[model samples]
Target chain A: MTSADETQQRPAGDPAGPALDRFYTVIPAGGVGTRLWPLSRASAPKFLHDLTGSGTTLIRSTYERLAPLTGEKVMVVTGDPHRDAVCAQLPELDEADLVLEPSPKDSAAAIGLAAAILHRRDPEIIMGSFAADQVIAPVEAFQSAAREAVVTAATGRIVTIGISPTHPSTGFGYIRRGQALGVEGAPSAHQVVEFVEKPGEETAREYLDTGDYLWNAGMFVAPVGLLLQHLAAAQPELHAGVVEIAEAWGTERQQEVMERVWPDLPKTAIDYAVAEPAADAGDVAVIPGHFTWDDVGDFAAIARLNPAKEQDAMTVLGEKARVYSDQSSGVVVSDTRRVVALIGVEDIVVVDTEDALLVTTTDHAQSVKQAVEALREKGDSDVL
Target chain B: MTSADETQQRPAGDPAGPALDRFYTVIPAGGVGTRLWPLSRASAPKFLHDLTGSGTTLIRSTYERLAPLTGEKVMVVTGDPHRDAVCAQLPELDEADLVLEPSPKDSAAAIGLAAAILHRRDPEIIMGSFAADQVIAPVEAFQSAAREAVVTAATGRIVTIGISPTHPSTGFGYIRRGQALGVEGAPSAHQVVEFVEKPGEETAREYLDTGDYLWNAGMFVAPVGLLLQHLAAAQPELHAGVVEIAEAWGTERQQEVMERVWPDLPKTAIDYAVAEPAADAGDVAVIPGHFTWDDVGDFAAIARLNPAKEQDAMTVLGEKARVYSDQSSGVVVSDTRRVVALIGVEDIVVVDTEDALLVTTTDHAQSVKQAVEALREKGDSDVL
Candidate 1:
């Protein structure tokens, strides 16, 4: 087989790092995924779906991909609603690893909760955090890169893995890489010059052309001490609250402290509350990773990762469709129960769920959040 | 309600026709609707749909619109399979008026069948034949025009109602008027100069700019003898065969003759076989009618007939949707069964059916036939 074809056919968990004795991979799997309405409802978010490839649910794929680096050391953080689905999908995770938040909280609190529990077990342990719904390929390459990033983080800098930009995509925040720190065989690490959120298409194109911007893939390799220190500097109250909770970890009082502290924690993205501040403070570093990656942000991106046909590449099966294209464009994803036929259409994303179907050109996929916002304004929580 | 609205309201039978006469509106309803597919299926053809106002089906509406002209004098010619649906929609028509053809021979054969049937009842009977799926306003105006055309037909000319063109439309054929016939207190009657097939957009625009051309609304007023005579002069074999079938009317031999003769018919349209030839012979008359009329040829035309809102003029429902230009300009029909949200979309026909949904720009609706042909090629007879 050709190298490209072989790369496509790599079995899950094969050709990667040895199972580590002390490494833990914590998946921050708790997100409402409201941006991807209908398909990614609160009941079934991105991770539960086999969105990336055939027979590979996003969480299942994530666990299998990470297994080579941290076998039996996987933990998932979710909330009360998706807790069952998460555990049911990953039954191998023990009860202690299934940390459930009593309410819907932001990623900062969830990560802080995971950190508190893991620190109680081993204060100096290195924890590599990954999101549940991401497409990272070339397993061997990813494992090697993760190992290098973790080692760099062990030396005290908070390490973030930045994916090479394949397109000028405004959907993702970008990491501007600074001067490199030498790491043999692995791509060099750099100081994160700045964090730019969802730039305009023209700006994204410029970033792609410049060859300096990396997509913030949201994967972090850090020692608990460094993450807590960064959090303390950025959000002193959250840092103190998490520290007090960690000191009282495994107790009912710890749960009380968490419930009291989390609501008070500003409902801000990690990019704003921690990553950006750390980078500004000159303590944040980004390691360039060549592993094929996708954030699967919207239906269009998901459609791209699992190319359907020629013009019609579908991430999911649609009934009796012949997808032909002039270029790698157009996607038709519908439940196998119904047939969706597309013809002479281009650059459009069609996602069909049981209740609601979305048909938008890829250029407007990011504005699908607008569709959700419209739905919420009309009080359509059933679809939201 | 206004008289125009009342005329438009009746979807079952025409309002001004003969009182409770066993109306059998002969619906020549068997076009491939290649210009309007996915929504317009072979089994459910365009004529069988309620393409205009709510509740009034095209066939039913046609029956009502023509009722003022031929009260209880309606007969339909359709392929055998669609006979059940035709009857289900208009229960007033007797089974005898529902002449079923073995195959889709063409419009000429279909109309010939109706002519033969009418000849058997009364050779002198004035037949006002119109297509079953037209949206015509001002019932009183149409009734007055029909009465005039019937009188004109009695005066020995094959009378065709010509609509004054509102726009340069490449989608329809054009009729040019010759010398004006001084008709009293009525829309002017004229000698038909010539019949032109669909012209180029530029030519259509020129024709629209000139007031002499009228849209060939396809409403023909004729006595059975006059049509038969025209047919005899133009297509002698068909005329002779139809005469034989009429002479052996309501007999088993008549049915046998029809079965044999229809299959042997040249698969020509009426315009090609009779109307165009009659005009060449200088024996056709044209009457300009003032009533509003639409053929509802495709989704775009259907959208045009819908009520306009804010000049954006697309028919829109769904509180969650922020429709910018959902006037009748681009008909978007979706069931309240599901929330259909459209954003930044315009001039498109988005139809959500129970089994299949079609989303195509109004201009592209003409290509919907390709979608249907694909379904038919795949033996999706149920959908087709």
Candidate 2:
């Protein structure tokens, strides 16, 4: 990660600076993240935690990362329960810039609402939709890509910052890249051929070999009007609902209209409602994001994001974690002052929180959701 | 275990009951149990915990198991640190009956001092030394074996209640059984044999098949005078230190004398200082015990002692533990109100305490001692 001064000293693409003036980074903060359970919870989700063991929370880092590029031009779309927490963690965020959802309706509604509201604020505002819980590094590279993405977005095309595949991971969806768009400031911009679902290991490995596939990290930068235009064409009912709420936003009728129509918005992800269809219609472009990134998908992903200090040792995490490991190789996440001892276990993950503890190996980290689901069924929702 | 009423109604051996009148059970509550750490601390130790989820601690159960036979003739020998805990747990125990060692000198000094004291209490009293951190079942069978051991001890032969081998376990020493001794009323008594160190897997299997070996539980039954005589010959310096302390016991100089000599007493296990030597001298006899027993040596041993409800599942232990597991088989011990969720790990062990946590697997449970040792080296003794 580069310092703020360093990033300011080297504005990614100096000439692309004017393009960011009309750009607003829309942070869609949501997801209980059951797969990262015990660490990620209903009341306090993934974005609220410092999953990387860095001093700052994921959402705060997200805000910090984009602040340099977009200045104070940012809006956060999150669930109602997390409003106060989001406000507290990112104090610079104004209450009015926070778009609190009545309930989750997935990516389509969450990001669409943010785009709709930003579009209302400024019709031609170029908006970048970045989830609050992703881990990214090499700030300069990310900012460089964002500049290109903003430039591409201004070309009346919905642009996504697609990450290059580092492994044959089946955990994320893939985006097939096409010929470069030859946009002046956004030289890396390519036509997005299509977006594919998460594939099997064999196919994922094959996708890696092609050098044409990038991980669809659900990040998008586009003119708010273009995003809303696509949503209006593909999900008209959902588009009308978000448009109504956006029109009433900041007015005395904001709460009244949001309570009336927000709950009934189409529950879908942006990938299905807009990105995919837009790609087919040759309206979507991709900017290959060269920066390292992780969604903190699960403990397995966490293992990769934070490598162990030793060659064959567990990755110990926490602000006050007292860990002692011997002849072991795995991951230990402690949220308390408790001393965690890991001995002779490979790829194991131990997550210790205030109210709950989660133990599993990296191989079986995905199964953690099963335990959470079982807890919910057993009325152990308090821990869940 | 048989109920007190049942055990009382059916005396193990009616004639042997009278012999228990002069029989005193010495409870050696020592060993920090580094292998069972987090659950067992320097201040708490393994003896202080109820590893079996039986609602009673190992020490308390040891006392209760022998109470029906020895009445109030029970003495606990432990380190000075555990004085309050041992006293609080066994309120029925007399103050004088609790022998607090100023420092650890291993089993030789501990059990030797107990025998020396009991000898002064009653020269003719037969003493049985039992550790306070082992799990045992079928009180009737255990009592029956104790009865036979007592009967044999009355004959001036230092006797051992050896547990019949249940598996080819390499975790415990093997007592190679000699030919049977034609002692009436003590049918299982065998002639003097040899005490062998823990054997290799193949050797253990061979010993098991031969039906000539029993797990040396380190449980000894002998007349106090005879026990002292053997200790006097084998560990003369240690024997003298204990004798002088026993002489000063109940007098004003007791504390002064113990503080002066106890620390320097020879630190050797009773198995090496007495049992093996006694067996070589043809002065030791074995009483084959048919009851289940475990030293609770490590989390792996804990896995065996407390099997999971499901065949392929983890063993969850703790009175107030809130654990949810899925597709994982191992051991989980939670001492706090924290809910523990286990998923997709085989033979894993997760121990959560107030200030410490331990994650491993049954296969590498013994390696926990290495972790504890590392913590000690790091000077993190507070958690230890």
Could you say which candidate leads in DockQ? 2
Error of 1 at B295 (Å): 2.3
Candidate 2 lDDT, A1-384, residue by residue in tens: 234543575556677766777888889999999899998999989999988878899999999898877777778999999988999998878777999988888999988888888888889899998999999999889988998999888889999999988998898999999999999889999999999999999999999999999998889999988888889999999999999999999999999999999888889989889998899999999999988888888999888888997787778778888878877787888888888888877888889888998888899888888888889998889887
TM-score of 1: 0.78
Per-candidate DockQ versus the true complex?
0.19, 0.72
Worst 10 residues of 1 chain B by lDDT: B319-328
Error of 2 at B4 (Å): 9.8
lDDT of 1 by residue, A1-384 (tens): 233433444455532222133468899886656555566877888788766545767888888777756666788988768878987788788877887776766878777667767877887767888988877788777876776676666666677988888889887889998888764423577778988888999999999998989998888877776677777777777667667766666676866776776667655556666778888888777888888887677766766676754333433444443332222246666653444554444565666566776666666667777777767777776776
lDDT scores in order: 0.70, 0.88
Consecutive 10-residue window with the lowest summed lDDT within model 2 chain A? A1-10
Each model's TM-score, in the order given?
0.78, 0.89
